[model samples]
Target: MTAIGFVTRTTHGGFSGELNLLPICAHIDIVPNRDKSGDTSPDFRIFTQGVEVGSGRILSGESRGTDYVSLSLAAPGLGVRKLCANLGRTVGLNGDGSFFLIWNSVD
Candidate 1:
């Protein structure tokens, strides 16, 4: 797993921070999707440079009841499958901020 971003909670129940993907470091915002109409709808929207790039679904750990954000980022350069990640608490991530966007790749 790789720590790709550092984010902190915002006063409006959102998150704002920097998404550092090597040479592309941009300030990003994880804002609540207030217009969501169904349970399957994304709970949050991710924006970078004022453009929507991804979405986040609220999730909970099965055993520990830990809160998490299941994120999906899609870009023309990222290919057919959207990049998926789990934004979880920073407790043991060895990173900054209250949450970390962790990328877990299966071999």
Candidate 2:
């Protein structure tokens, strides 16, 4: 299994916030944008324990060289941070920072 690490921040009491280490399994599908002509546009479908939990697309960063993916969780009742942690554990991607993707590998 491969790991993909992401940084998560949770706000508390309307003033304080905590930064947490989050990771996700690499059993993901990078679906190319069919509407477009090339494979440059991709959408990520993230899975945990062989079940899909979230999907996201890469977004252009407000600043140069700062692109990020915006995830939309569909695992009912799970916050973004919790979902990240759970997905990481389920697919054995619990690491730090960002993870490398090994294509054509099975989890």
Which candidate leads in TM-score?
1
Q: List the residue pairs that clash in candidate 1.
A: none
Q: Write the per-residue lDDT of candidate 1 for residues 70-106, one digit (tens) a residue.
A: 8888766556767777876788654445888787563
**Local distance difference test, per candidate?**
0.82, 0.36
TM for candidate 2 is 0.36
Report the backbone clash tally of model 1: 0
Off by over 4 Å in 1: 92-97
Candidate 2 least-lDDT 10 residues: 10-19
lDDT of 2 by residue, 30-90 (tens): 2323454444443555455556555546666566766555544445434433333122212
Give RMSD to native, each candidate. 3.0, 14.5
Model 2 misplaced stretches (Cα beyond 4 Å): 1-42, 77-107
Candidate topping lDDT: 1
TM-score of each: 0.82, 0.36
